[model samples]
Target: MNTLLLHCRPGFEGEVCAEISEQAALIGVAGYAKGKPASAYAEFVCTEPGGGERLMRELRFERLIFPRQWARGEFVALPESDRIGVLLQHLAELPVFGSLWLEVFDTNDGKELSNFCKKFEGPLRKALTKAGRLVEDAGKPRLLLTFRSGREVFVGMAETGNQALWPMGIPRLKFPREAPSRSTLKLEEAWHQFIPREQWETRLSGDMTGVDLGASPGGWTYQLVRRGMLVTAVDNGPMAESLMDTGLVTHLMVDGFVWKPRQPVDWMVCDIVEKPARNAALLDDWIGGGHCREAVVNLKLPMKQRYAEVKRLLQRLEDGFAERRIKVSIACKQLYHDREEVTCHLRRLDR
Candidate 1:
């Protein structure tokens, strides 16, 4: 009962395992991570009795780069018959939970178990409720039961305040066909993750202006214009004519790295494919120079050390911002639409 289950993108199991091992060692909780490539999940078994819970407490979810979601629990092997009884017995031994989410890995094999989970939820909830193990109060912990197969399951728990908002840490996002490029979904997901929905109307209103560097074909630019903002799409390559027809876009042909906005704009966005360090430094300059109030930049990662690179870049941004006495909010994520790269959103609070 001292194993931690972590869900991550398929093919990133190695990164997840490495990150967990390093993070666990850093916190003085000796542990070993093990998972096969493309498993879409990994596990860390601690050497100490209570080390599992301690690892969870020490590692912040926001700071973890590879794992989308995590939970501390033990593996429960189920008998072929009386599976429900076995599960109910385990639930009885654990504390009452506010919510229960039955999930599987984000892989093809995992998707095959989705129907089972959906059908199992009803009877499981009924059983838990009958035994008084289910509580609807939001203050209680969230129980996560991840099934690798019908015969095996991992029972874990996470504090509601610290856990991910969705099951398996994936948000349901639909792409708009009207957008010129599929890259539009990256920016859309960025806003959902970085900016609170309640503040959208006030913070992303029509009166605001934005500059989209590397705006060829107008993927990220579409989001700004859709929100009814006047946008200057900066790129040497031609933009989509449909985007220009909106009568709110000004396309400028120039190098995105060297070009500077004539005046301070409400927002700045860049999706240039370059080194992560360069992108991080560019963001620091953008916010530090007060070129734009906010910005979203993408960093294309290399073959190895992806998590380490992200950590270093974030620290660099923090150090630069502190040196300039700039008050800002910065968030980075590997979006569902993003591959081999991460999106960073930076907002400067000072006028």
Candidate 2:
């Protein structure tokens, strides 16, 4: 494919592919990771089997991007969905739907999709809505559906039948797979919002330590130990044994809210399933108490105005951390692996 699709937040792609590559397993897609996260754009071209979408298996990211440059055709279809479980089955079997090139999104009021919605209903309509928002323009797409079937099992239903015949001279193909994390995170490429890996590598020196709140199964902890820092992973659930074996990762077995580092630490990383405001307040306490020099965490998002919430929480965090002269750099990305919430990477301003 000459074109590709990039999945991310609506406006922050300036730095997504690099962050993705930081943790991406070497086996999958192969392509250049370029573009901007500030515009919520990320494009990576790969000739591998899984199109790098499978990378979500290990890393916590915010978007599912197929770069437009890898696209062999001129047009693509878009869908609106909150989960990927329903889309993966069909995508694995179909040809037109396997790997995509350039995926985009559209909201309910999308101008390009007004006519496409006429043929859909119920869950199908919902899916279409999501696809419309994800496509470059809201219009009848040149792609086919490859999702698992429910009450609706027919393919090409969006058109006449099992096949959609276009002008032979035109080179249009369908995006093959469909998938989240706000835990199953949500990301829109139009926004260029994707996860960052640079912050994870920045470790404190001179006896500084840290804690991983909600550190179950070890996503954030993996990043900490790699930085050569000691981490007390605080959570009620079981942790990844590999992390436990690292000597640097300690299982605290406590609620992050009530727990405190015996003394100041280097960072605090949380992937808690709590309200955004609650998490923000907790970070404030950490900075207010001088417990850590920097932090990176994930905040689960609710259904409405997620973009606005990110802005709101960031303001509160900045102001709260400011009083203590704790300078911070915060990055909120709609990673490919994220379900609906955004990941926050924070650093003390003075760092």
For this target, which candidate reaches the highest TM-score against the unseen true structure?
1
Tens digit of per-residue lDDT, candidate 1, span 1-351: 588888888877877888889899888998899988889889998989988889878777766767778888988998887778998888777889898889899988899998888988899888888888887978998889999998898989988767666789887877788889989988988787678799999878899999998899998999999999999998888898999999999999988788888798989989988888988888998888999998989998875888788878998899889988999888776666678888888898878
Clashes of each: 0, 108
Worst 10 residues of 1 by lDDT: 58-67
The sequence of per-residue lDDT tens digits that candidate 2 reaches over residues 214-254 is: 87766656655655778788888887776777788789787
lDDT of 2 at 151: 24
* Candidate 1 RMSD to the real structure: 2.0
Those runs of model 1 whose alpha carbons end farther than 4 Å from true positions after fitting are none
Candidate 1, residue 102: lDDT = 90
Q: Which has the greatest lDDT? A: 1
Q: Report the Cα RMSD per candidate.
A: 2.0, 16.7
Error of 2 at 88 (Å): 36
